[model samples]
Target: MSIMASRPVPRDDASWRRRRLGLFSVCLAALLLPICFSGGAVATPAIGAALHGSALEMRWITSAFMLAFGGCLMAAGACADAFGRKRIFLLGVGCLLLTSLALAFSRSALAVDWLRALQGVSAAATLAGGGASLAQDFDGHARARAYGLLGTTFGVGLAFGPLLAGLLIVRFGWQGVFAATAVVAALALVIGTRGMRESRDPAATGLDWPGTLSFTGALASFTYGVIQAPALGATAPEVIGALAFAVVLAVAFVAIERRVAHPMLDLTLFRYVRFIGVQLLPVATSCCYIVLLVLLPLRFIGVHGDSEVTAGLRMTALSLPMLVVPFVATQLARRIPSGVLCSTGLVLAAAGLAWLARTVGAPDTGVLCPALWPMLLIGAGSAMPWGLMDGLSVSVVPTDRAGMAMGIFNTTRVASEGVMLALVGAVLIALIGAQLPDMPGAVAPDVAREAVNRLVAGDMHGAMARAPAWGEAALRSAYEHAFATLLDRLAIVTLLCAIVVFACLSGKTRSGATDTADLGEPSTDTATP
Candidate 1:
């Protein structure tokens, strides 16, 4: 029996044309999802400068979107299956169009943060519904090809988003970033409206409301506490309360998932050692790679005084390997054990991070600086598991549970990215804050704290304006030190993850099979929604 579903080919040429058009529409919409994620980080400095957003508000501009997107993703897929794929897809595109347009005109940071969250929700719907619709429209070989193209489109967006946003910002300012997203959303809406066919799963057990709410609440609360910790002190009542609430909700979510007839996440899957190893791949990448995508842009544009275009070009070096290295990793897996390949990749990334930390503050000569090699190394290293994680996600579980396995893997990947981004940003702020008082010409304690907030928020000009005592040179030096320290910590975490993943996957399975046999051929089906 084949792993993929089989569907009858459309007899008429017109039906085929419609399906092709639907693929293009969904692919276009899918492209915007990563752009929204990566581009927001590129635009953060400009947004902070224009809106005069405080540290917390600036963090929310990015965090709010990510949290909402990750929290709503699994539920959106369930809604698509239970309700109607085309209906939800169109609704998502329409809402995205509205939110993007609103975001383009918004003047307040708070308003932008709220709008970005809505955009995240809309993007989730677009991804889930659009993907499910494609699964319905084609199957077998055609399904594989369509999904392969969709995945490539997503990769392209992630790789080039910063560069594109930088070009737009340079020419039309920050609003141009949102304006471009709106244009893309509008095109997707028109094409999708004409081409998409409605479909729903007959056996769908409906949305898991309790589990969804609890999981979302837990993530949002935890993220809130982390992002606010620097500003409100870790022991502040609000911070402590939010953390406590998040813990309670997380426990509730676990209980709800165990009790529900159709849980969004099947917790029992964790019993498989291989499954646990596969899940850790994303967490590893998030620490070593994904967090850097956001932080590097901020550091280049804000701390280092690099232009948006320059920062974007620098980021391209970091992300470009993702477009090519994943394929190379897949081929290498034919000769090497997948576990060995994954752990080796992470080790390389850890080395790259360590190298990067040492080179970041060096005088920037041009676009290609000393940091370029480290960025490329990190990208190449992380791409290895990036290629295999999807296939491993499904293969580790029983074939009948492939869809559930895919969902859990993706949720772990995305949710971890969001959480890590928030945690790292908070840590960076704390690290910078700690360095401020010790600087040669440090200001008063209160003023130094405010400077730390502004500095971490990517408001370099504002920070200097607030604390002239700590001169531009001293401030920059402090930021460089803090950023390097954060990178070192991340490197250590990645190395630790690599060790655990290797152990979990290197061992023989219960069936007395070597893990390398599970590598097989890479799955062409899209595991992400």
Candidate 2:
């Protein structure tokens, strides 16, 4: 296999460049995928004064899509394997276009909520399918580079979603963001139709309806419970039922997956210590990554009296790193093991979070400054693991079962992101409830603060406008406390990564072949078509 002895490999620089460029298109498509989640919430405060939408309604606009998007990955991943990657990708893009159009024309909060959910579901298919395609499309070392490129695109999309939305929103209003996103989705569909080739694992058959149904039901119930618990109250019947149903469905799903011939989700992957630990990445990522962004604005308003426009601009710090660093890190990871990079990135993120946590008492401008670097670290760290794990995940499964393996990966990433956010959100609310004050003319201080929480949580604009005499100051205190509580979120992520690597580094720190060997090699692993 000496370089000179090997047969001359053909090279097509133009095609190479074109394929390289395909990565960017995927990123552009991803950029708006997650943006749909925050559509109403991000828009509400900035224009709430003008639009007069309820804060609760806006929050739903932000969170509802996440639930739907996460709830469908298992099915979508299987769809990619069965129908073919490029074709399914087109379908996803088509759905995204339609949903974005619907969102653009949404007249009321409810319509926006439903459309956002649809947008999220479409985005989920795109995320899972597009990612899987990158794997099937690239070969050898090129695969790693493609992975990095894909990672960069995802990071860029997440980072730019807010910035782009902010600009369009400012220039043409909120609907502008929707319209622009629709155009992007429509263009993606066209490009995919023309250039992308279909990739279906010929051996991948036996669609797992039972597994899909059971897992979907379980996850849907769980996501509903988490999203609704805050608004529904602890004892609310819907929340309780959702939680109970989730628990039962999860147990049933596990039992079913163990026995089903072609299951929606296979449970044996968990036995691979590396996959199990890496799985935690999603939980940590979803819980801590966006949770603060969700809450940080309250700090800006309460402490510095900054407008929503200003707060959104400042968030560019977090978004920018998330976008830029992945492009850099993904390249470097070709040489460096993802674990070393991941550990280093987490340390950096922990430092950033620690600094951010310490600045809670400072001015809004100063307090948020600490977040910039950690945001970068988080972006890089997030990309590093995926660069390694995804390749490893795909390669380990038997060729016939590749679709199932990928489906699990996609389902876990989205589902955990949603659940983790809920976990951290609950912790933040429980710990930082002290910062919120009662709205105008409330009786008990605690109840009043909860009301403010409801208000801030509901509509900071309206809350700020009708706040009690001590509202601003009280809200500031609540934010300070919340920031303090955010430390717990960071600490959890840091501790989880540290513990997993320290304990299981021997398992996950190896090459793909090594991981497969250690995991007792899956029964039906396959090669690219």
- Give candidate 1 regions above 4 Å deviation: 1-10, 438-446, 507-529
Cα RMSD of all models vs. native, in order, equals: 6.0, 6.2
lDDT of 1 by residue, 181-277 (tens): 9999999999998899999999999999999999999999999999888777788899999999999999999999999888988898787777899
lDDT for 312 in candidate 2 is 65
Error of model 1, residue 187, in angstroms = 0.9
TM-score of model 2 (CA atoms): 0.83
Which numbered prediction scores highest in lDDT against the true structure? Answer: 1
Error of 2 at 41 (Å): 5.2
Measured by TM-score, the strongest candidate is 1
